[model samples]
Target: MGLRQDLRRGIRLVKDVMRNRKAQGKLAEALAAQPPLEPHHYRVGVYFADGKVNLYQMRQWYKPLAELSKRHPVLVLSRASGAALAMLRESPLPVAYVRRVVDLERVIHEQDLHVVFYVNQNAKNFQMMRYGRRWHVFINHGESDKMYMTTNQFKAYDYALIAGDAARARLEKVLWDYDFDKRAIPIGRPQADHYSGTLPYTPDERTVVLYAPTWEGDRGAAAYGSIASHGVALVTALLATGRHRVVYRPHPRSGVVDHEYGVANRAIIDAIAAVNAADPGARHVYDDGPELGWQLSAADVAIVDISAMVYDRLAAGKPLLITRPANPAAVIDTSGYLGACEWLNAAPDPATGADAGASMLARVSEVAEDPEARARLGYWVERYFGDTTPGATTARFHDAIDHLMAEWERFAALHADDEEVDDHDEEGEADEDELG
Candidate 1:
């Protein structure tokens, strides 16, 4: 069995290498066609080191970054060729493909970037963080109560642009001796202001249910995925009910770690396809698209696992159900939103021989119509992302950037006469290995 697995891994590695080379070539051609970026043009830089698989992290920031560029020009510094290629094609902001450490340094020298934003905790982020004279701020991909939200890595950045009160409170509990006032800035959820994407299906009387589950986690403590547990049953039940429209948007990395989880994800997609084939009017969607806003805004009820989708949907100030993790080892932080949010259990009813789907239908109906649950959702929304009023979050986000830029000018004046120090000596040799 070990030898067979090794062979499969070897084959996958070869395919990945070939694919990456092709992407690199395409990226080079695309870059050649566009005129080079003017020197010292961009003041804000977003550092994304992950490959194409994690582009969702960068995608969510596109609209917000584009809007910010109006005041302070924004540029995306992409480390992976695939991610750079995708950004060049679709991103609203300019993209610089700095696949090598030296290439990244060139951008630093050419551009007067005062604020660099990081979307995830990718290890390669440290490569860029080593540079001084600029602020390295952690503006995470999404807001959630997961352990990732309060990681010690938050200390590594100069500052963190958090969601709101709940985020600040979440950090204060886990991080020790951290200066929240100086380091953490509550900008609310700026992405909420620009929920892009058009509806795929026409609106109807059918109640739309968005089931956006996270990936099967790498470890036991993070095993919060419901695809293998609550997903199939609930999705089946919803599809069977002619009155419900199911929008299945599984995590992009779903089943990357587990075979069973992958199988269940495929099953849900197949179910949606079969249902749509039989009834064209049902419009049961198998959503693997890049856009996220339409599903959140259009859905009457959203069922999500213990991931960022919880807060993403919550920001909509809409009714949603959280799927209870079937894994006993999975850690649950009830200190914040999860503690009070409504939960959907994965257990099957033995007495009635009913699956979780039937129970999910009832829960969905209750959450959709319950005045009390709606009231609770309103409170949590304000707590996590204050002032859902259109443009409120966006204004706050720009204000934060303006504040940082002003601070940069203040410090730049203080160190104006100091000898310029080069920090690239520590970067050593750049890794030649490319991600597919």
Candidate 2:
């Protein structure tokens, strides 16, 4: 890793330490004052809520559980995810919001939860599920190629939901080798169900092209160009059409803590801001989460680099485009400085379009207007969504939560009301807030 990457990892580690310390302290106090009861008979707690819609693939797996709420009182866990879920509830579904993982655990024990479901497990999320909750269910985030994932991911849920047979096969192939066969369920993405149901009150009318770039990393947008370069090279050509709405959606990590200034790289973010403000057809949308159906609804096609938006766009079977640079040997990464646009489509560069001003509009326009080209893209979407049965696959994702809830019950039965002394080896104050 580069120095900046090393520093970033260090900073994240420091934050993790602080989180655990605070939660541990609270756990001790709660143990000392709680009642002992068998957890086999407890409520179920589901940890999820909606994120932004433009980010399609990453909605916290809450919508499907909407079905589960009819049978039981479901506890929805989140930080600001609650706000996103308000509209989703539509005046139904008994929901409780716990802002942190520690809060979830405490609530799980107190409520005697029978199962706990976790969807979208990234590196940090994996660390959050170590509570030995009796049964854990997982709804996986899929990959581009339907193949086995690295074993460290969340295949350990009592069951899992996959988008389709291909997704199931891919998930099973990767996980069973690690003995997670008994813990997976092949199902579809529930959020996909979300879009079909209701249209928001005031939807943007123009062909909304959601331009979401991944965060800065070894191979992310920050390396290529600031918001300006991407805007000029990719977004601008389309905006010049004066008939499209280009939504500049950056990765969820593009927050104040990520960049030096709250704004993205000055050159690029400034360009995007200017373009968005200047053109009625373009505007940048900041994320609260990766829930992006509203934006996706407005889109005729989604243009992305190596972001999940590509796969999510396929969920809608909408037209999608991925950018590739003309040159293969023009990529770079530095310690703290933003890198260069090295993330090119490695295939021999296509001569159909140019990355400069006018050429982009021509090539993209041809693709947008061509029904055959779009059909080819739809084929790609089918390959990605893989799930033929939506309800079944959604259950697979919820299965994990049920198991986790069950585990919480067993844990409460075993570790009720007991005191333990501290054996700390760190010196930072508690930061339990970030767990959401």
Candidate 3:
């Protein structure tokens, strides 16, 4: 039995390697025929290495990154050709596919990039860190209490554009001697300010409930995803309330780690379909699209897992319910938002013995009219995201980038000779050597 399991694991690894090779090969062909990057001194760059695996991360920055591009020459520098093509194909942001380290070296020297922003903690990013006279910033995909948020990896980046004070506190507790003021900049949630996309259903009077759960995590501590445990039951209860419009948006990579979880996810989606088919006016939606804003902005109340979706809905200042992870090993940080959050536990909690269905319906009914419940949302919103008025968060985001650019200019001037000349000069020499 162990031998069979090992064989299966080996087969999956081989398939993954083959897919990567194919993607790289296709990328090489495209790179050979592709045009030179749009000639401009890119002040800011978004560094991405993973192809398709972390595509959702890029989508989070799409609107805000595009807006930044208009002011400064913002370019998406992808280490994988396939990643570049994917971004260019789906998003309008200009992308440069750099398979070779020297190619990236040329971009840094030629563009005179002042700052480079990273979406995820990809190990390949360390290659870019070797370059000097530029600031390396970590702008994570979203705000969450998941272990990834408090990783030692945060120490590597020169700066991090965090959502608010909650992130600073989380990092301080985990990392010793970490400079929160200098290293962390509170930009709020820029995506919250740019939430767009048309609502699937018309806004007559139905209350929209968005069930956005995280993917089944890769390991035990991170296994905060509640799709298999709470999804079917919670979604069923919401749909049974005929007046509610259910917008089911599972994490893009949901069930990738667990087969049983995947099966359960499909079951929930099918259940929504069945409901829609039986009642055309139900307006039940199973959202798996690239768009994110519409659901958050449109939904009257949201039910989400203990991931980035939690803070995202909090930024919306709307009523929300967080699912208590069925896995006992999953870590729940109760310092800030999660402490104040209402939980929907499948198993009876000592304090709230009500089952998941009863708890969900009761909260939904209460939030619809309770002014104090809505006011409580406001207090948490201020704590997680300060000053969430129209355009406020986006302004702070731009200001943070501007601050980095200004600081880079001063630092670059003072340390002009610190810039690496060997890599850039070698690239030019190599071209001449080829010509000779």
What value does the lDDT take at residue 44 in candidate 1?
A: 96
Question: In model 3, where do residues sit more than 4 Å from their true spots?
Answer: 1-35, 348-359, 417-436
Name the candidate, 1 or 3, with the larger TM-score value: 1
Where is model 2 more than 4 Å wrong at Cα? Answer: 1-42, 47-59, 77-105, 120-133, 141-151, 172-181, 196-206, 218-229, 255-291, 325-355, 387-436
Give lDDT: candidate 2, residue 224: 30
Per-prediction tally of clashes = 0, 36, 0
Alpha-carbon deviation at 109 in model 2, angstroms? 2.7
In the range 141-167, model 2's lDDT, one tens digit per residue, is 444331123344654555554455445
Instruction: State which candidate has the highest lDDT.
Output: 1
Angstrom error of the Cα, residue 15, model 1: value is 2.1
lDDT minimum window of 10 residues, candidate 2: 333-342
TM-score, every prediction:
0.97, 0.62, 0.89
Identify the leading candidate in terms of TM-score. Answer: 1
Model 3, range 109-133, lDDT digits (tens) per residue?
A: 6686788999999877887877777
